[model samples]
Target: MSKTQKPVDELSAEEAADELAALAAEIARHDRLYHGDDAPEISDADYDALRLRNAAIEVKFPELVREDSPSRVVGAAPSGTFGQVVHAKPMLSLDNVFSDEDVTDFVASVRRFLAFPADRELAFTAEPKIDGLSMSLRYEGGRLVTAATRGDGTTGENVTANIRTIDEIPQTLPADAPDIVEVRGEVYMRRDDFIALNERMAETGRTFANPRNFAAGSLRQKDPEMTRSRPLKFFAYAWGETSAPLAETQFEAVRRLGSWGFRVNDHMAICRSVEEMLARYRAIEAERASLPYDIDGVVYKVDRLDLQERLGFRSRSPRWATAHKFPAEKATTVLNAIEIQVGRTGALTPVARLEPVTVGGVVVTNATLHNEDYIKGIGQNGQPIREGRDIRVGDTVLVQRAGDVIPQILDIVPEKRPADAEPYVFPDKCPACGSHAVREEGEAVRRCTGGLICPAQAVERLRHFVSRNAFDIEGLGEKQIEFFFNNEDPSLRIRSPAEIFTLKARQADSLTKLENIDGFGATSVKKLFAAIDGRREVPVSRFLFALGIRHIGETNAKRIARHYLSFEALRRGASEAEIPQGKGDPGNSAWQELVGINGIGAIVAEAAVEFFAEAHNREALDALLKEVTPVDEEPVGDVSSPVAGKTVVFTGALERMSRDEAKAMAERLGAKVAGSVSKKTDLVVAGPGAGSKLKQATDLGIEVIDEDQWFERVSG
Candidate 1:
């Protein structure tokens, strides 16, 4: 709300998306700094400000919030030193409410769900939200046993040794405590101690961005002595796993936590209404700056544990509780330049190169422009979008990241734009391979036309060849494909799919062995060779899919395989159909026959033909086939029968054959199975409870058969 850019309401969908990406990047950096390193660069207030802005933008753009926003997640990735720990119960994230209206809506939604009367009281426990790492300390038999960071909710890094050094966390709980308990809360450093720690770092020629990062980094040190040397405190505000109930209400649980010799937040209170809840938040905010440790906002939870259970959870966060986050920080910088990165699929992605600026404590260098249209500010209709504003190099742009973790360019200041700045021209050729890059009709992306020659496309195709649905080779994966493809020596490099099968023989006489590679061991190398050899004979459908031909997906490949029955037959047929010279009618040309198969459209047929038309592709196929054989597609039922190669649709409830069994049987008999009934459908097997499909079949005047008749037709 305080930035130089237009209000979230005034921005176009493209502009809003750009802003949201920036916020996400910025927020993620802060999370890593505070939770991962315990060294937050931004103050509690500044960080909170970014979060508040993020919520505002999200409120205006709900669909955009979902892209990269980590609003629900609480902690950063666990440090590498400690071994991992899986929690008995998942430590879920919490939803955030940034305004009083949001708070009011949250309460109202709860009451409406439970059908509670207006007079019914809904008490909530309101407490300061600590700016520190979330830890789950597991205690069994009233003794502190295991301590872990809330790493991605389900699992965390084991920090048991470092946790034992914290004075506030009792070494042992009361004898009357539950037999097993996992106390969940924040581990923070007091203001005085943080200042002292900073002073020590300065004297020792070491530096941390802020107290939060220092606290997080200090707490997760590999050396237990180093952890003990630092002054750290804990506030047990929640619990993860407990053998028995801690209390009936949330308020009572905090008190129970205190009675168990664990340090609990002293500022917690019971707020029976939304007004009371917001008042508590205000009270906390008033004294936030003076607090010994950082408090970004306040968390409010439904007091009654039963109501909390009834509210349950969404996919990721709790329904009965929400954190009231503050706002995010923002800054302005010059747009240095725009760079394009070629993805595996060959689409060039535009990235913003920005002068480094600090947003919520992270040094922001790059922000995603998303696409060429985003950089040029144009819509699909070639109309001016984003109010006709285009980003250019040497222009001053507003960079903002609302606690969303990513930084984005909000807007460019026209007055600050360089007088001689030139418009960015998106390259029409592949930056990597120098091939013609063209975008097809009805598609937004421009891809490099050089699929076979392009190194980027080649690597991706190799990956697809060995993917699970394709070859499914055990040990040969993307890394191996990359390593083998990118080998510096000319003869050793794997240039095509055929080379993968010839690796063992090629390396047999060479001084260097695959087993001698860094990642490969004797057992792995043997397994890799065995896996490659095992795939010598494979299903035709899998082999076709493994070719990595454009637009020929799994279903299309299966349909094509069923149509041709064998690799040689398919290759000859595809090679003969040189161009788009076919009709989608049965008993036509080979191209027409391919197009006639259900789900195999002209586009897919053309792609297959195009692949075969190339002499190099034909050569590659010949070389690969010499080493391996694709088993002819075996008839599912009887390919020579009347119903063979027919497109059959089974609708409604079948009395004899189950839906899956019927489909499988149809495929076994060499029938092309389809889910829906249409003009292309040759036969419709209608059973009882047959609805629209049956009527449509009858209306189309297509042959309609019953379960018994269908079996008879197949058997006869």
Candidate 2:
């Protein structure tokens, strides 16, 4: 169950009904976020819990099932570029029931809905819900005909060519099979395959957020060959359309599908009672972490075909079926201390340092407290809420990692609180610059005082912005960065990276000419302008890195920039994160999406979001963008380039460009660079300091070249 949600039995009918509406709306939003954008904010376990809560509520108040109940929805409507195809039969969704009571209620509801005798014998079958894209395969006359996705249940996208490439999917079924059959199942990438694909993507500076999205994006590629490159497998769990009756029982139909060479999950069984059904669900949940693919829940369906038909469906979900989900990842840990972090913008974010505990396969020693209010259990409206329970130091708190990589304190266990536990007092002063940390009305975060005196934070940022790993401006060395940063003359001082672009404009209004400045000359000034203009169009990844958000380093920044691809798209995602979500969740949806990236944790996501949240930060970025447009992130570099998959070394002074530039270029060509040359070094570019490395390369028979030769070959 969701941490924020009240138990179904505990809620009044009206409250339960309202909760159902909220849950339904929340699930739909998630569907669009995950299905439409391939960016899901919550984890599978978290999402399933929401659906489970919705089901439990509906079970308590069956009549309150909304028209938009998520139970009825199949996979998010396939809103893709592929041409559309309508399923012969709608790909109906199964209702979900989380607990034993919900399962018992489901069986009882089926009997009541069918008007069957209480004593009548009934059987049900359970199967794992593969966490993958749903594809409907249509075969005509024992030959492959068409393949489609479960788009909006009734409509689907045509992927016949792509599906044909999967060796697991048979082009032609057994000769004895029905003339027409639509094999419905999931198209998935195995766990090992997913890990390998991610590793390969990372080596090339590209990556996938998760396996399900990777499979969906891969299978839906415009070019079928692209889909063929992905290692995707399929499992036939159910059928959509058939020319002849396959069997009377659901188990028999699945067996017949297996007999025809269709892969079916081995962990399936017929359950005689709700207890047996619950046992199966527990068993699946236990084995879930080991499964190669993902399954959000275990789906149970009535075994008898006639009975299933009689039970039919209630609006969107079949009354004969319900999915029992696994519990989300949650654990109790000591709240060792609360550490306060002052970001670039001076926002004092409270971070929870906890006793090491594992949640969702990751050791979590740190979690976000979000704000001081969260520790005090203050509601968004400033009223006391969540039973007015404040999270105290030394409290045994519930830490949970939902679809988010960052763990959070769900609630405090008052009973387990330490005797010496004391209320945490949030600092009113900035911890970094010793300035006033003031909170504005209607804002949850506090900001540090800003001025010339406290420009320490901005100064550090300026240094990073011009570092070789960032924008790598040739003329903008540390001395220049510091000089211009504290320029004494207000007209020339740069407060942010964006102001760097406006230097020429700022200089134009000054009485002093840059060329006449003591250390600068006509030639030097021109060279400086050339360097600045040369980078007028900066790479998006470098641009993002130059901003210097907390926890976001070069690698993650590059990943984020490439993922968003454009400055405008990245800004929009940040802006959208502030909008209200389904249940007043501060939305943080875009933040959640950002966190979904493999290495992007909650802390990093929060930093990015906070950086964007500030009006000053946004203004500075906008000003910089007006002067210089950030280039779209480059695609994963040429893996087949000449230097691809080779190790190289640069052991001397580089005259053509900075060593950073050489490394970037070599990496772009898919080459591994090492500090020391050995037998593994395919080539060595030795310059002025050639000394030891030169002799070593000669002795090791490693290819040795000069700067001129190195540049000549790359250009060639």
Candidate 3:
């Protein structure tokens, strides 16, 4: 564990919940950039770390899991540039393991779940985990019908025309193949091809970042002829939505795919034991660089189809398969300077500028410093890092791409440090707005207090409001947000969310028209207006999240929206809720009610109350609400469910399912899952060791039932 992160065992439930919310939002944003846009901001290692942290927290506090948790979501939603194709079978992602011990545990978990004796041999197929775009080719009656890119697991972009251009993907399957089969494979560009392509495009000044990105860009091209011009290959490894059984085992199925005119990796092998699995992984790693395409790691899957069926899957990944990722690559570089970048949340993040160096085939010029403490060789728990040797300008620092993607400084070479190098000083004020930057207790990051006044923060917040996960206005993105924020004409400028909805009206009244702008043409300006008008009514959850309240992300926003059912109700609740006076203060009824919702805590309640209480925030919110209507979220699952819209609580041990699972089930039945029993609780599900909550429920005259009875009532 990094010193900056608190141990999972040590984190309080409230802290865990807050961190989970933040991680979900951060990961979602990265998913949009990486999966939807094919432009990643962080390296693979950094992304994995965030996910691993989330998993650890979820393991320690399972009941705190939110509906929008990263563990439950796959790739981002389709970008809407192509026709949408809903997968017949969901295209789930694989859970990742970074260490040998984790791999061993994974196998042990499979045996434990299957109740298999230790002496019995279990076979698994180990293959190279490709680093490329996942494409699903659907065949019907031995003819190719559609090819789609995995988009959020359930839906994908229809790239059938583009896919047909690749010779490696067969236009028709062999007669022996299933009548309907979705052959899942990876579309990749060979390293040499990628290099040549870059060289060819150098004259145009538009080169790709990596082979994986190049393959994705080529496959997503709107014109099929353009895709045909690119050098792309496919390797089939799995199947989805098969009309008939293809084979009895994993290896056999892959062989059948190869016989049916799909490229199957020759390096794939069957491993019957843990030792064999590890040996195969090592062998694959040794030959990874020599391969024509990139392989990030080795994927191991249960070979037997029966065993795979029994193991089934988790919410987002297979229970019988996992990806064992390769270790990060490191290099040494000179640190020239440290720069501060302010985020929409006012976080003052430090970035280290380094002399250009190559690590893992990618050019490295910058790395994340994390925070002031990290730069000063101080850990979050006040421990020493790198023997308490602080980093300085001109120091030769060891850097690595975390997950072969994100560049990060590991430590400095003391002998290479310049004699005149001085201890770096962290700024106490915002670099953009000159406002005080203060670090709060128990927090590692220092934040700017400038709020909306800071240009960087304002622009970032505006961008986030129009982000894919929020309001998601089609014509409004980061570049457009920045352009409008700094526009010279007052009528054309958009510094706040309210101004966006009023852009057309403002432009109509002004002497200058948007069409006359440098980048905006008549057709583009009309489309922008239509896009803005399309978002006049948004879901209450998205509306709440767009406000960007501290400690409130998409999951927490949804929780609040579900609890209150409307923006007006949530605002009223926040206004009536009183902040606790001290450590032991119980606070007012409204506060108690807000905190009573499962996955919600005092931290979130306080933040929501604080945001609503601020005079400027209220003024801006009132203005924005005038232009947009926030609609209540439709009830999930069966609207006629007996527990629909009812507040339900669970007490004691649940034998049939885990606490988190029970909560999820109840939620699916359109019931509100509460952490504590109160007058507002409509039902209570009690089990073995039922205690205080059950008594409280009885005293409140709420309906109480045993776990089995509760399940019986909700079962469809």
What is the Cα root-mean-square deviation between model 2 and the actual structure? 20.7
What is the TM-score of each predicted model, taking all chains together? 0.50, 0.48, 0.62
lDDT of 1 by residue, 36-91 (tens): 66555555556666776787788888888754576755566666656779989888
Model 1 spans with C-alpha error above 4 angstroms: 1-97, 100-335, 343-345, 354-367, 395-416, 472-483, 488-491, 515-524, 554-589, 596-598, 631-646, 649-671, 674-716
Write the residue-wise lDDT of candidate 3 on 1-716 in tens digits: 67888889999999999999999999999999889878676568779999999999999999999999999999999987877899999999999999889999999999999999889989999999999999999999999988899999999998887788798888987778889999998999888888766533422224466788888998887545457768899999999999899899999999999998889999999999999999999999888666878789999999999999999999999999999998767889999999988887788877899999998767899887777888999854687877888988899999976434446787899999898999998999999999999888777878889997999889888987997668999988777898899987888899999999999999999999889889889999999999999999999999998987877766678788888988888899899999989988878878878988888888889899999999999999999989999998776556689899898898998887656557767877889888877678899999999998988888878899998898789874
Off by over 4 Å in 2: 1-26, 44-75, 115-119, 202-209, 332-355, 360-716
Instruction: Please rank every candidate by lDDT, starting with the best.
Output: 3, 1, 2
The best candidate in terms of TM-score: 3
On a 0 to 1 TM-score scale, where does candidate 1 land against the true structure? Answer: 0.50
Model 1, residue 94: distance off in Å is 16
Residue-pair clashes per prediction, in order, are 35, 2, 4
Relative to the true structure, how large is the alpha-carbon lDDT of every model? 0.78, 0.76, 0.87
Better of 1 and 3 by TM-score: 3
> Global CA lDDT of candidate 2, please?
0.76
In angstroms, give how far residue 292 of model 2 lies from its true place.
Answer: 2.7
Best by lDDT: 3
RMSD after Cα superposition, model 3: 16.2
